[model samples]
Target chain A: MTTNSISIGIVTYRTSLEYLKRCLRSISFQSALDSVGSVVIRDNDNGFDREIIEQAIAASGLDKSLVKVVEGDNIGFGAAQNELMKLSFEKGESAHLCLNPDAALHPNSIENVLEFASSKKFLGIFEMEQFPVPHPKIVDPYTFETPWCSGCSLLIPSGVYEATKGFDESFWLYCEDVDLSWRVKAEGMHCYLVKNAQVAHFVHSRSNDSKEDQLRALPLISAAKHLADKWGSPRFSKDMAKEYERRSGISIDSDSLNNVPRPSPSSLLKAQPDFSHMLVFSPSTWIEE
Target chain B: MRPNITVVTRTQPGRESFLETALFSLSSQLLVPEEVLVVAHVVSSGPFVELENLIGAYKTQFNSIQLLTHSFEGDGRTVSLNMGLEKATGKYLAFLDDDDVFYEHHFSSLVQALEKNDNAWAFSNVVRAGYGPDGNGYSLRERSQPFKRSGYSFLDHLYENFIPIHSFILDRDKCPSEARFNENLVRHEDYEFLLRLASKFPPYYLDETTAEYRIRLDGSNSVLDGSSGMTSEEFMLKREIWVKSNYILDQVRKEIVGWWAPELREVTEKLGRVADYLSTTDLTKRMEEQKKAQAMVDEIWSSTSWRITAPIRIAGSIAKRSPIPKKPKVHSLKDGHEVVNEIKSSFAWKITAPLRRVKDAKLKKQP
Candidate 1:
């Protein structure tokens, strides 16, 4: 066990067991992870491709004692993270890592993140260099700046997670990490990019045959939610709305397409609106998955 | 499960090379389409002789290439897609533009996703790939990740339609047998069809990069400079349709939020606290006061400020005052790229630069 105690939380949707096995093996092999007593797999109950993942775990022959699986109905991403956060509080641990099922941690990624959390004066947000995918820069969500860590592999310090209130359940998918990082920054805490840490992320397909079109709409809805949350929806402005939809991978109805109103007077006065040129509907209009 | 696949292609004469590439990509690397049907308009231009030549090459490679060339009774592309659908035989249908290429993993990925899930309406991210003036190939665009929601419904359709026309794959069993692309809507026809599809099935995403969406200078889906301007007549019609649809959706969404708002007060209060918790400059403080001035608009959204403020939101009418725009805060790294200033620190500069200067100074002293 390392000097600080950290628990890892992995959220699994409809992912393959082979990947999960690879994921567990990678976490188990973390050179500095002895400090981690338990790794919780919060399985979003679509009956996770369980048989294969279990077989893979057995094949890897890692200590089964350190692994625990939690099954539940389809809770949103933020809710799942909150569940892990609640678990951490129950165990009296200080921090929990929200790892994507498709992502694998490097040997010392947890240690590096913890090391930063242990002594850093302010809220520290560090993202790893996503392996196989060459995105070296970390982005700042508040500014839409590049290099913000992809949620695929993020180490959440317990303090920052609690302060930020975990992921926003309103954001069912897409940009939850960006929203979290932004919310963390909103609380006056700083997010960082640890150049040394590396996480292997296997980008998975979000859609299968059963619900193809609905899967396509997820990003569109999330984008609208993001824009509505960040840049109040405007009355239809086709250009800005199209740009928003294209860039965010979100879609909107043709009338409401650019029909969301411009920034409310309150937002204009409180802080500069991030997307003044774009239009959005009320944040309430976003569909929860 | 067998490869339940359908191919939707609208062909014209001169696209011989595009046809060859599409056919080779579809037949060689991906799942063999249970039925490959091509809908071509009888028109003037490239040699039907050459079109036949391309068809022959594809047929040699795959057994199911059926060429159904007809002089369309209508003049729109959407009509052509509707025509193609009438002839499609497979249970799973994927739209392929005449000018696109399918990656090796496209069919396999779609097939796997369909097998894994109970509902099989899936779409994958497409790479905007372009051939340079020099004949070299390069990726022009990239998608960061696949979307989260996966179920087809009308509300999903009403939300947005960013799915590229050629990027979608449909299940034939749940397929709207009479569904037709909106022939009158030239610009957003795909958006309309997707909306109809979403109403019926839960959509899914194949996060894999499965196809290359070619960006051609002519005869393609690229939006040109003047092309962005909407005709006044077309604009008004679109607006009328949108307002009607959004009203219904808005009503439903508002009711859902209303049911939770009383219990969600804590969440709202927390959001308010989070808004107040945002870092403030002297200017930011004044902005906060101004936000409270307008009671009707409970929130403001824009890209300028790094934060989103939750306002004392009211229903129905919008506030008269529009928010001012601000530039996002940015900081530059030593490597010349800039980032937001929140993460900037003098310590980062202090940690990175001194070693180089120290080495240089020591060399001079030794000399």
Candidate 2:
């Protein structure tokens, strides 16, 4: 296993075959093709798309030996990704790319991220470029200091992943990314946004629906309460519950969250990053073109 | 039954014309008062004679005109008000400054509002007439578009005195007898009294411009009189004193309520701590300190020392990276291909070979 080799991990559940094929095709066409030594797909349900994924892999024209699919019961997103990372580490891979099922990478995304990772000594998490509008995890353009980066297409080096122990599995669904990012930063490791390594994420289309999706808020509110309990001020949790109740017109059962573990006092007392210089507005180029 | 209303007007000497206007407005009220108790501060015999003569002339038009004289002293209004409050015999009480006048329906509107809402007190909007910047003549002050009228918020009331004293009409029975003007407060006595009154019952708002607050140009001893010679620091100190006093009185109100509940007492203690913290740290001083610290940071960032140590800082960052752990020896590409070749040759793969062969058949069928 070479230091520059990358292992790609994808977690799929009821994902469209065409989108999966496009994702595989994009990876096959990456600029540094030989650097991607392994591709692991962990299916979080019964292998319904096993044949389809095999057909897509055959169509992608990559090394058939490098591709492997493992099936399991519906654990969760973070849990499934953890399984893939464990597999990648056992394979002696130096870097792991946690790619979302609904996203397709740009042609040079892998090459660009690997280049940047090598220059930085491959110690921090590097988020890939998001198309259309960038993720709202604002960073100072000059300092490269960000509050947190999204988990949609994060590239984690083997060393940092092993050190931070990946995502906290307690967060079943949402805010797991924030928890991971904060934990990584707490260890004095930095995270950066790799602007040139782009991924075209299709999740934005899911948000454009006109109707209010109240059901989706249940897990989100639960995750937020869990986060606030662990590492945030109690007032913040109370305010979040109140605001969600007001906006969604559905009361959250906060009594259920009593069992969540509180964060260590040291983590709670960590100094917050200064966001006074954050640029909240979109640049003119985002709107013009 | 119609309640008797007492019009308590506290006057000082030499404002005869303004007093007459106030009195005339009262005399023309559709709902007349039981008596106009004129608490006059007469420092000399001449002013007393003038006031007595003036009341005597209006005694015919009014049902009763009583003139109670007091010696001129510091903060004569609060002192005379407490004295006049004793002489008031009406079921309802309303105050009027000698320099301000009420509209014809001022007392009637307030009475109706208080009666309709079953409120202990009612207050209306005022048309603030003051000299323009040139000090030439009086004109209506240009109020903000959304004028904040009287409301029933104790927190808002604590921050500001939105209800003018003249605009209020109190139900004498509902007002606690102990709730009187704080003679110590030369400046916000009326505001302080209203705060105490509001703690018991929020004033009902009669949203009508039914009174005129006269602002004199000659720097008279009125609440609206601007401080003439006070420096900014002196003015700020005066404001801080008033704010501190208001906060103390507010805390007292909270403490009285806190006696019933332990939680409330705890909350009040916390609030007191917060207030103490706020008062001890002057915002401007803190801002200046922050500015100085920021300047120091900027100076350091631009200094030659920072520039010279840039490589060392870069080296420090480079040295912080932990060495990557040794990778475990795993199946190489040739070994992986051998496993794939084995799977292709196995019985299960051969059994599933027919299923996998459907792609060519499906393509042939499509053509």
Candidate 3:
């Protein structure tokens, strides 16, 4: 296969089956499927819904040899993507696409991104065309340059993936993409927004049930604390904690954040890129339709 | 001992008849106030002259009446109230809108409730009278009976403004000066003031209706008049903005120090964990650190001492790159045979044997 060939990676936990089916159907019709080297799926639920996923794939009528399913314990979103990336790299794939189970790509998304990515010298972090409202990453419409992009749908060159060591495993859910993007920039690489490459991410609706609310709160708080400490601002963490407490009537225990590993000052001293200046486009700039 | 009470009433230019009626209601109170301080605003000297003449007529009937007038420019009820409060020498304080009236037992009922409770203020239920949608006057259209037995719940008060301004009485000494009306707010000043009071000292509730809230549908006297050309959505949106801008939620959250406080604190702790985990401020600080480090490196390189160590640094670099002897790999014959046998016996080799033979034959034919 040529160096421009792409591999798609999807990590599934207890995701909705209907959403997964639609995601697979979108992938089956992609124009770049002919150039797709492999499709690897890591089931974080240890083959809990493997049958249903396999049935969806079979119904899509894509070549069975093109897909590979690996069952394992729930390592988390970032870690599972890392596993898929490793598998794709071992298969000699040049680029890796990290996809959320609930996201579906537009037909020409993969093809368009690859075409644009081939011309760039550094590893390109392609942005997703989020449906309904675009992810609030300011992007230069003409140049496709952005400060940061969501990992819901990202196209990462293998070279860049290896250089940044994938995402920081510290983040189990939210803000992992931001950490990865910053690290990529620190390595003197630019992340881009592919204006035409659209991926409709079906955001998971938050459960109103109080138990589920508590369950969801834990990871988000953990991630926020890790980011604040790693980046060096206790104020951001305190403000966010205060806002959450005001909205939810819950006091945040800041003392628990002491356990999170902080980035050494020496490591921080290596790169001093201004995050605000990373965006090439003004806040008002956005994609039409 | 009877607590001396000062009833401060603010009236607009054209509300002389309503102000007279309000003063009459105070005169009929079972426990009369020590003084009825009327802060009336007039646009021109004509209205002020007319109000002085009207008060002159009431002075013969009630000797405790006092009138203070100002040139009216805008809604300055909060400013007038603060001025009235400064002149108030009574042990207890009460407020009366010129358009609203109190029942005969309003002062007595509130004082009794405040005396029984340790709270700074006390409020009674209020009956609302207004012009109905049909243009006909509706007397006692609604009563604030629900709040009569509400006791003192700061949480409930956060979500609503149940205590009408005129229905409440404050113990002047117990009430903090900061608990006065917030002059900054153009609307819902009463609710904002009550929220501030509730945050520090939750007001006691008397299970009695001792006041009437007169809602002039003509939109002249009432600030919360629904007839002010605002759509229901607009009204609600404005109300929400007022509540948020006044930090009502923040005040209520701060006062959540009772039974539910621990639960809230637990929730806050969990949320704090989430905030800490998701914060990107550390990344911002790292960028700063990086700049400082770069500056230090630049400084060190430009120093004369660094120039003197150039030859030593070059020798160190050469020493760092010096080649080391490679270690020889030792392989056992038994281990090599075992690896070859395992690969040959693997399922993948067995399954692809036919395809491998066909590919080999095809390649031979092509040559």
What does the lDDT come to for candidate 1?
0.56
Q: Which stretches of candidate 1 lie over 4 Å from their true place?
A: A46-48, A119-122, A136-148, A204-221, A224-227, A230-289, B1-367
Cα error, residue B364 of model 1, in Å, equals: 34
TM-score-wise, the better of 1 and 3 is 3
Query: In model 3, what lDDT does residue B279 have?
Result: 55
lDDT of 2 at B156: 50
For candidate 3, the clash count comes to 29
| TM-score of candidate 3 on Cα atoms, chains taken together | 0.40
| Count of clashing pairs, candidate 2 | 0
Alpha carbon RMSD to native, model 1: 22.8
| TM-score to true structure, per model | 0.38, 0.41, 0.40
RMSD of each: 22.8, 34.3, 32.5
Residues B259-327, model 1: lDDT tens digits: 553445456545533454453335656454444432212221222121322232211113635554333
Query: Lowest summed lDDT over 10 consecutive residues: which window, candidate 3 chain A?
Result: A280-289
lDDT (Cα, tens digit) per residue for candidate 2, span B15-53? 675676577556545466877899987766554666777
